[model samples]
Target: MKHSGSLLIVDDNPDILIAARLLLKQHYQSVKTTDNPFDIAGIINEQRKLEQPIDVILLDMNFTQDSISGKEGFYWLKKIIEQDANIVVLLMTAYGDIQLAVDAIKAGASDFIAKPWQNEQLLGAVTAAFSHAKDKQQVGKLTRQKQGLNQALNTPNFEFLGQSNAMQQVFSTIEKAAQTDANILITGESGTGKELTAHAIHQASMRHSQTFMSLDMGAVAQNLFESELFGHKKGAFTDAKADHIGKFELAQGGSLFLDELGNLPLEHQAKLLAALQNRQITPVGSSKAVDIDIRLICATNDNLDQAVSEGRFRQDLLYRINTVEIRLPALRERSDGIPLLANYYLKHFAQKYKRSLTISDDDMSALCQYAWPGNVRELAHAIERAVILTEGDKLDISSVVGNSASVSTDEKTQSTEVLNNVAQYDTFDLDILEQRTVRAALKHHQGNVSHAAKALGLTRGAMYRRLEKYGL
Candidate 1:
């Protein structure tokens, strides 16, 4: 197999350099030989200039004639490490001993090799050294990437809080699922805290101390999907000026949250599936495939099953990502949960804005009654907005009730008139009430489904179903 690693063999004896080069050249992508030890620094610098640093170095212990103390090898070893501490160095000498090997290793040499080594032994040693060097390089690269992404990794401090039966079941599932390395798929409506749930799982998992990298598939351009998820080499494309570590590598030994997975293009789903199935990824413009150890957690607001049936999604990919599926209920479906979330965000935003604020019992009741189409995220935003706008100590229901938004007095009067007109029939039948309410809302909103849905405390999907049911 062709290797992407580079090897450098340095020996004072021309014959040794020639022989080692000839043998290692077949296995390594780049192999350099020099009979002069002084050329080591120059050669290494040149490789760095080309962005292909040496992976392993075979150094002779006695570079000068009649010198056998191996101090020369130790000197160069220190220099190599000084240049790049992660580079693997192997010491070679004609006069070899167990003590020399011990001393060489203690001085940071990867291994000790005796002169006139067998080809198989030399190949084995170099291969092992190259692997070790690659590992170190990967770790260093990930550390740097983590430093760069530290600012973007601002995870929220709140847990997924809900007391309704649906939320209680979700909490139970999260606790159980976090115990294993199984891939988790969080399905929910938009603004339902899918990303937050992913964070909760990562925090609850054994890999809590490690990274929790999140990528919003919906926000990423389709053309950049592979590069964004699997990473890319420096100069991989017109804009790839530097090597970029993908989310998979950054989330090594942790959780990788792929938000909006259903938005992934069908053509790109195969690439993701291949990586997950193989447990490895080949960066764009690079032939080497890197093995990754990450617990995968994906979230989506779209109905993937319907998409799959419509041929917009792949069934196999769906199966691969949904080993444990946790669907978050819509805000309206979470019975008595809105008040809890609203109060939580109220206190949170109140402190954030440095204001003392409280929600009245009546206003809180109105908040509990309205259907939060935007879910917890919307509720948080609404509370924050109220906290910022309300000048009084107590929150005003004028802005917090009926869709959790500020509606003009005229609009409120018109909507109440519509509801009152619909209730004038005096029929206590729920179906009749629902049909009349849907019609009235649609009329009041000028046939705008979104506005009508929000005013009626219903999701767009629920609104559409009602429209279809009542033939409105």
Candidate 2:
């Protein structure tokens, strides 16, 4: 799979830098490295020219044997954050100055790792930081899109564009909720514009002038959940060479929108509840708590009530984060909004790619009829693909909608064969069937052993050997 972001590792120790680079190179296509923190800004400028933009920074607090206080790294962290608040910075902290890491977070570090860190922990931190950075970037992109749409319409300002009763009620609720400090919970299926709803509430609220930060809970790993949400101190572990800050700290005096909140592990939910109740959070390895002044806005696709009934989510956490709840209807549910959203995306993409395209009535009808399982995201991607593949100004729905018949036929045939085989073997042992299933999945994913193993509930090595056994 292609990674969506790049990372930059800065450390004075050549060995540490090399190790970090080696570890991240497999996951990220672009992993830049530098031993001197002073060269960071220049390197960032150079890397921006590359096809893929750098998304995260890992900085070591202490530079060399002589500079013990990590003041240089601390200054660089401030400068880098000032230059680009979007980049996620993970501080490398040493064992003795963990307090310094907490201070560094207050100064602007995204998260931190301790010295002598486990490989899994380091990887987890990087992944979490990069994921958070990507979410922030998407929020910024959406804000710009809304602004551009307003400019195109010559409107006084951008507001949610819908006249339906459902949307009118949503607007009214948002306006009323914006005046209070209560945590608001927004729920809907994917691509129902939950993030947009969050942004609208933020813009309409008393904290409009303050920074707005959003995070996707579904993207981060289970192990690093604590460090990513609460942050960690320097030397808190082996990889901690500097101090770091958590999301709660960064969202101080602002609104923290936790998107896809239902995806968070049950273990992390309790901690989050405590933070919401106390209005403060302590770094993962630190004992002291930092005060935070911000409103919480959480969104999720899954039903938290169902999750709690199933014991997969904590009811207490849900109660804490959802003082006010709003549910956005899916595109199909709001059929009247389909043409509006389609026109919005159509014009947006046309201008973005410098084309004069118009959506015919026939094309609009097809878009409305099609089941958008992936919601607005799928719709946007479909429009972009259609625009790129199209030779003329008008979009042809035949080419843009659904897979080719030949490809669909092949998939149907394969699925039927798999089902038939399982049915024929009435006495089949489930364990053996599972092993065979793993091998087949590996072959289907083009030998992506890890993904295949995950899908089949088997270890990667076990899946690899099964493939060999089946001569796949």
Candidate 3:
């Protein structure tokens, strides 16, 4: 088969150079030969300057007189690689010096062939090496194109208010982490706006323009976790009808928010830890690994240290994700920011619903005083509901305070019951427990499926299915 790639042959022997050049010239488009190995650098440089660089190099391992150790071959290989590392360097050695040839390959040579090789064997190796170089070039081009597209697309913007000192500190840490490419772990109780903070960091960071993909780890099934995080090829599994780009691949050059991370089981944590540590992922049903470039931001309501002690979370994975840990203050703790958040939600909902609604001082006090087990999320729902239902200009405190207490009480009771069931029954129906947990989360977030899903460390799709299953 004829190859389009150019070739460079370097050897100390005139006969070997002439014979190899004559043999390879028929198979390749351009073949350059040099008997002095010292002149290989100049030859490669000239080729590079001409914009017709050699694609593959056939280098004799023992180029110096009385040099059977192949040190000269290794030195020239290093020089060639330094000039252009992408070029394939195939080493040639005497038939009796096969080990030396193999060692040269280990040092940097791409491949090795013995002297007096079959013409067909030489031709086949060069073709294969040329094919690999072309494939690498094509892949590099595609990666650049995809990265350009990802950076060009518009990403959603978010604004975070942090009037309270606790929140101000959170903002300060966020600014620090945003400047550097650090994997961040945001921790707090439910409804603390971990996801919002993640968006804030992404919007303010250097990768602000790239995609910000969010995945709820808890919502994904155990079997599909790999497919969801690292992607899967077509025919990877029974349901993998088409190729899929996992969150890690999709969030290239940007941020990936793995919400509810503590929900990942121990078995799955190993897979996640491996991908993160290696900075690469192999899609399901594919042996080839794809390199990933991402800034990770993860959120978890669970205390990871406690979970690690209990054997629910991996210690190594914990260390990997939390390069910089930022704890967001719960709503009750940030009293100063409550009014701002409340009014923001009120104004937003009022305009969205086309209503004239204003918060009363008494109502603001009620919002500030509430325990807010659901944090800002519960408060936002209270404000939005009041905006939708209240007819008068000034919204009263009764609706929010009254409904919140009842819902909070109900959630507590339901949680206590579930804990009791788990502690008492050896074979309790998991469906019933899941239903109760879903209901409590929904009630806690005031029937907002998305918020409730976050509170439950589940994906919205997963929460929706349960809502239907339990007929909530």
Candidate 4:
């Protein structure tokens, strides 16, 4: 397998690239070279998408014409790992730069070589890496044997549903990280389907056939954090009538999704970090260290960076879990996807409740226009409520957004009265008055043009021109 593996050598030096390519050509099935380190991510992603990923990357430690430091190598190594940890990278450096290449190992490079090396030394390192790759693939297969394999595939609610560009990047990240045993940290505002995304990742992963266990850190009591995560022996405590397996043991060889990760107790952060670092857990009242195998996925609405600054979180723990970070786009950022999500929820709940329902175009537009402060969760609840309450087959969003986005029926009547006063002004002085009125409305709204436009009975674009014309 090592002999048949594909190899990618990235270096700014073409002569060295040619020599390395020629040397490895006899053993490796394919040898590709690139002078640009920036293009490696795109190349690797494209290769993985085509199911022809490179097995190993021989990377140079320096790139700048006048530079000697291996900073360039570390940058590319991180980029490569962020894309896919499955690709084994061996950093290449001259004898004087050997220390820098060694530093790359801490940055995720599998191995490093001092250049002007023997042919046998490089071959041996590459051979060992392919063997390691084979072992890694076997671990994935072993994890896939865990219980509840089909449950994930059958659950439609766990599906990743989005066609927006943001979601495309998310899906791509999932594809790259899922196959590897990398710890993934998913970040987003609440109700953006963080758990759903975690489930989707598990389903797409090599561990899909295994059990996907999840626990809400915010819901778990501070006292129960240890017992819940690391199991409890019988009679370990007053409530421990029977031995209980923890999430760690239950999800062994699979994935454990820790939702609300930021809510974990400060007292227990160090314990959790130690267990993760050592890949071992000690049960309550048990002296034996239990070997654990779990791919970790954690999600949080709270900012951990802020938490670390406040000394509430362990920075080391953050580094351990965030091997790859996937940030989900909020519904407001991907407003175009609202109709799609709305329709999806409509059909799902409609079938569940045995109801006939459809959303009108005007209603859809209103739903999209309304700022979803609560993200997709609010939109979903609104749809479900509208479907259940409406007497007609079509959904009436009037009741849904009356207090927020849509103009109330009573307000419409009052607006009609305000329009009547417009003609009372002198026609020649209307322009002067219009500018003054626009400026006053904008001032009242604190220069929020959209609110000002709504207050002045003008569209946002119309308000823009009036502001520009008057320079207000």
Q: Which number leads on lDDT? A: 1
If the candidates were sorted by their lDDT against the true structure, best first, what order would they fall in?
A: 1, 3, 4, 2
- Writing each residue's lDDT as its tens digit, candidate 2 over 1-472 gives 5476778999878888888888888888888999887888877656653435568999888876766686877888888877666788988866436687788778888777888778899989888898899898777656644543342233222235666678888899999999898899999877667877888888899998876777777656677777767877644666654345667776678788887787777778888888888888988667678898988999988899999999999989888888999998776677677788778777777778888888776557557655564566556666776776677777754455543222344553454345335435644465477567665777788878777655453434344556776666
What TM-score would each prediction reach against the true structure?
Answer: 0.62, 0.55, 0.59, 0.54
What Cα-based lDDT does every candidate model obtain?
0.82, 0.73, 0.77, 0.77
Error of 3 at 196 (Å): 0.5
Instruction: Please write out the lDDT profile of model 3 over residues 62-112, one tens digit for every residue.
Output: 866776776777888888777666678888877436577567768877678
Estimate the Cα RMSD of every predicted model relative to the unseen true structure: 12.0, 18.7, 15.3, 24.5
lDDT of 3 at 143: 69
Q: Please, what are the lDDT tens digits per residue for candidate 1 over residues 83-126?
A: 67778999999999999999999999999999889999999999
lDDT of 3 at 192: 82
Task: Output the TM-score of candidate 3.
Answer: 0.59
Q: Model 4, range 154-248, lDDT digits (tens) per residue? A: 45452468888998899999999998999999999877888788988898899888878887786577888888889776446778744457788
Report the candidate with higher lDDT, 1 versus 2.
Answer: 1
- Which residue window of length 10 is worst by lDDT in model 3? 149-158
